[model samples]
Target: MGKLLFYIFCFLAFNSCIELNNPPNIQGTWELLSATTIRNDSSIVQDLENKRMIKIINQHHFAFLNHDNNNGKDTTAHFVAGGGAYSLVGNQYKESLEYCNFRDWEGHNFTFSVFIKGDTLIQEGIEEIEELGIEQKIIEKYTRVKVGRKRNIYATPLM
Candidate 1:
C-alpha cells in the first residue's frame, strides 16, 4: 500500500509540473509603466514621470524604445532604441541585439526574468555598466496595449 501511494503521488506531482502551453504567444505592443535601475549596492535610479518608453514584440523579434523628451519623432531627445531576435522559455526571456543606438550593444545576447500576468508584464535584468564599473539591475513594468488603440511615437515603438 505504501509503494502504491508513493507512485500515485509521484504521478500527480510530475503531471502538475508539465507545461501545457510553454512560451506563450506574446506578440504585441506594450506600454511602459515604469523603468528603474538598482545598483549592486541597493541604490535605486528611477525614470522621470515624463519619460517615454515602449516595447514591441513579434513572433521572433522585439523592439524597445526609451526617450526623455517625446514631443514627436523629429525632436525625440535622449532616444535609445534596440531590437533583435527574441525567445521565451518559461519565465526566462532572451534577446539578441542585432541593431541598437549604441554600437557596442549590438551582437550581444541578453537574458532576463519575465512574468506576464494578465495585461501586466514585469521584466528584470542584470547588466554591467563599463563606465560605472558596477553591476546594474534593471526592472521594467509594462501593460499590454490592445489593438486599435491610438499609436504614438512614444507609445508605439514598432509603428
Candidate 2:
C-alpha cells in the first residue's frame, strides 16, 4: 500500500508541473509570415508575399487585415479588412464574420484548426472566397510582432 501511494504521489507531482509550464498565450498581434492556398488538385498559390497582414485577437473577437499599399494598385482602398466575434472550443476555432470589406462576406462563418507553435501561429481551414469560385484549403503562418509606434496603424500585441 505504501509503494502504491508513493507512486501516485510522484505521478501527480509530474502532471502538475506540466500544467504549470504552459506555453505563451495565443492572444496577440501576429504578423503574417506566409499564406498558402492548397487546392484539391495539389496545386498551391502564394498571394500575400508583397502584402502586409496583421491578425489581432482579443478575448472575444478577432480581426484580420491585409495591407496592399505597397502594390500601387488601389482596387478599392489601401487595405482589406475583416473582423468578427470568435469562439474557441478545444482545437476548433470558429469565427462569425460581421464586418468585411466585401459585402458578400458579411454573414459568413468560418472554422479553422488553430495551433500556436513556438512564436508562430498556424491556421488551417477551408476558404471559399466569392471571387475565387472554388473552395480551397488555406494555411496561414504568423509570428508574434510588437507594434512600437502609434502611427504604424498595426495592432498592438495582447497583454
Residue 72, model 2: lDDT of 54
Across residues 52-80, which tens digit of lDDT does each residue of candidate 1 receive? 67799988899998777656555435778
Model 1: runs farther than 4 Å from truth? 1-12, 69-76, 129-134, 151-159
What candidate 2 gets wrong by more than 4 Å, as runs, is: 1-24, 69-78, 128-133, 147-159
If scored against the real structure, what TM-score would every candidate get? Answer: 0.75, 0.69
Per-residue alpha-carbon lDDT of candidate 2 for residues 1-159, written as tens digits (9 for 90 to 100): 999999999999999887555533668888877777888778574555456788898888999988775565656336779999988776578889999998788878888888777777888898776664758888877877766733233332221
Evaluated at residue 84, the lDDT of candidate 2 is 94
Would you list the C-alpha lDDT of every candidate in the order shown?
Answer: 0.75, 0.75
TM-score of 1: 0.75
